[model samples]
Target: MKTLLYIVLVLISFSVTAQKPVVNSAKLEEIKSYLKHFEDNDALLGSVSVFENDKELLNQSFGAIPASRTTKYQVGSISKMFTAVLIGQLVEEHKMDLNEPLATYFPKMPGASSIKLSNLLNHTSGLQNFVVKQDSLKYWLKKPVSQQAILDEIARQGVAFQPGDSISYSNSGYYLLTRILEQKYKKPYETILEERITRPFGLENTFSLNGKTEYEDTAISYEKKDNKWVKLEEFYFPNVQGVGDIISTLSDLNSFMSALFNNEILKEETLKRMLPKDDDWFGLGIMKAPFYNHIAYGHGGDTYGTHTVTSYHPESKLGITYVINGEGYPTNNFAIGLLSIIYDKDYSLPELTEYTPDKLYYDAYTGTYSSPELPIAITVYQKEGALMAQGEGQSPFTLTPKSKHTFAYLKAGIHITFDPDAETFLFKQGGQQFELKKK
Candidate 1:
């Protein structure tokens, strides 16, 4: 009996030793330095929070806004994860089933009778993304849309494919789910969210905007125009309810994600349903996003000028959440840089010096250029004294001059070096270079 007791004590000791706390102040400083590079260059304007095992490692806010832990920003589609959790709660109580057809709640929808709840959650309903249509902005931007009007707009598009035949993202599906939730509980989505998730989790800075909620300390979103920050809330915030209207802080998002992953807010089986498995990158609302060597689970959000990402690595017990009210640089790069720092991996910071080329240089490079290796032709033009390049079927992007003949598109990681004498340019991207001749 004594030997058995000794064996048990040894196992407990090993377990305790295995759960050692992680601390690396140097690595944390590296993350801070990387963020500062973006802030100094006017590339990022927002807040970031990182936690390991629910312990805060870094919490910082940058830019013109007096951002704090309580400052809320519209999290866009990150709200979908919260909606998924509410659905999970209803499923646990036997109030709803994932396999139930949408027709049960939204029979007026064209394909509602065939689309299942799971299809909406996993983005397989094949419902047309109504918001992407040109007419949608004209209708929703100027005024608040009634629930019926939103439904009518979705119905007008009909299904792009048969239900569950394939996967395509549809905000309309989430909108319908929101209406179904309202019907099931006979309560406003705001009240449902407050009672079900925010209040229970003690998330004081998280709330939904239904155009009536009096919210304070919200971040003002901005876009860069002619090297200036232009506020966009006046033109953008309407008609985003249910689909992308929840406002939250970085700390609160981290807390909510940590609670959900820790099984404090969801049953084990329900949480599993939300996480990606079986070769599927998306599960319910949460999706699998790989960061370096870690497989992180979370969702990214974009609405107007705001961009946000919330991800957690279950194996590492790490959570990173950030919200950018003004983004001129790619947010994914920031996520990669932060995670690389935490894992002690090599990463490079952005070089922020700006260079301007003369009009003669622009004139020499202006023309249509194509390469035998590339599938599309690139048209180079000058816009407001700035060099711009547009590829076939893609929008125009401004090129930042890195040298006399070299230009870079930092967001896309493409570099171009012009050869004025040869009337050609070398296009370098993804570590591969191809020479294109002027046509």
Candidate 2:
């Protein structure tokens, strides 16, 4: 009797240990504190949800008007992942081929004969991003654009590079993919998305932005103006269409990601094809990024006044997602901090400080800086009383001074430390450092 009783107790202990949550109260409190810091400073206005397997570890919102889990927000480029999954389903059903040329659908498209479906999925099709071009933006933002208008814009331009030659992010590629889907299915892209992906998964809050004048329960987007939140004017959603027009909630997105990785939406083989090894670190529409020592796969998005990132680690069965309707800080830092705490890694809470540097001191750092190891030269100059840095082929970005010699570009996660005595600057981003000399 004594031996049997001991055996029963041991089994109960094992069961309790096995079912223990991966994250602890201490870590969760730390995460909450970190988010609250941003909220207190008016830098974060959003919702975050982190899940460990089937258990939700954190689901909280911050701001004057907090958003709930069901509140819809425009996910921007993350919509590409949904489009990619649709293509994957078609491929699984043998209705589509990844290696097929886009010319099969739109032969009139410039260089369509050479651009493969894979090229578009991985952003290597050499197509110019119509949304980024000044003239195209001027036209599209003014009114709702038809599919033909977008196609015409794409056709008017030459290929940026040979298809599959190199990787360049092109919204044009995904927009064209949307048209191909419609042509193949003989239905609108939204209809196809509903029939093929969202409906089957029971994703209620995930849908295309069609025939919707206003989104219900959606957070109002804001931009910081004179240190106050200012709502932005609405743009034509249809202009982005399949590229970046999907609206979803945190819960729905988490459900979709969970279903996708669990083989509920795709076959193992089809999923493998979507995760190709590429120079751009993007496979299909998903991006693979490193978190601590583990690799997480997902996509980030930015639109108007919204920023979002959703990623999952297969090894740990952890899914992390956040959407900010207003951002005055780097969104990536919040992601890094959340993931670090989830993994029981060391993460520093954000130190929010506003700096006003003297114009003379800022001007001293204004010059062109180049590194032999890096291909691009960075130009530093003053813009509107702020120090700005611009790399070749990139737009100018304001640098926030962390100290007299240390400056940071929050959006890019770049930190630059100047060595006035040595006349050099150390550029740091993503754990890599490059030394640049002033020219």
In order, how many clashes per candidate?
0, 0
In model 2, state the lDDT of residue 20. Answer: 25
Q: Name the regions of candidate 2 deviating beyond 4 angstroms.
A: 1-21, 134-139, 278-280, 353-439
lDDT of 2: 0.76
Error (Å) of candidate 1 at residue 31 is: 0.8
Q: What is the per-residue lDDT of model 2 for residues 27-107, given as tens digits with 9 covering 90 to 100?
A: 778778878888887777888887778467788888766688788988888888998998888888899998999889989
lDDT of 1 by residue, 1-439 (tens): 0000000000011222223225478777777787788878877788889888887788988865568878898888887888888989999999999999998988888888889999999888988665555463533543566666767888998888998788777788887888788899999888999999999998999988877666889887786655667886532333655667888889899999899999999999889978878667779988887643456788877776677888887887888888778867665666666666665557788676777666687899999999999999999998898889999889788888888899888656789999988999999986899999999
Best by lDDT: 1
Scored by CA lDDT, what does every candidate get?
0.78, 0.76
TM-score of 1: 0.85
- At residue 59, candidate 1 shows an lDDT of 90
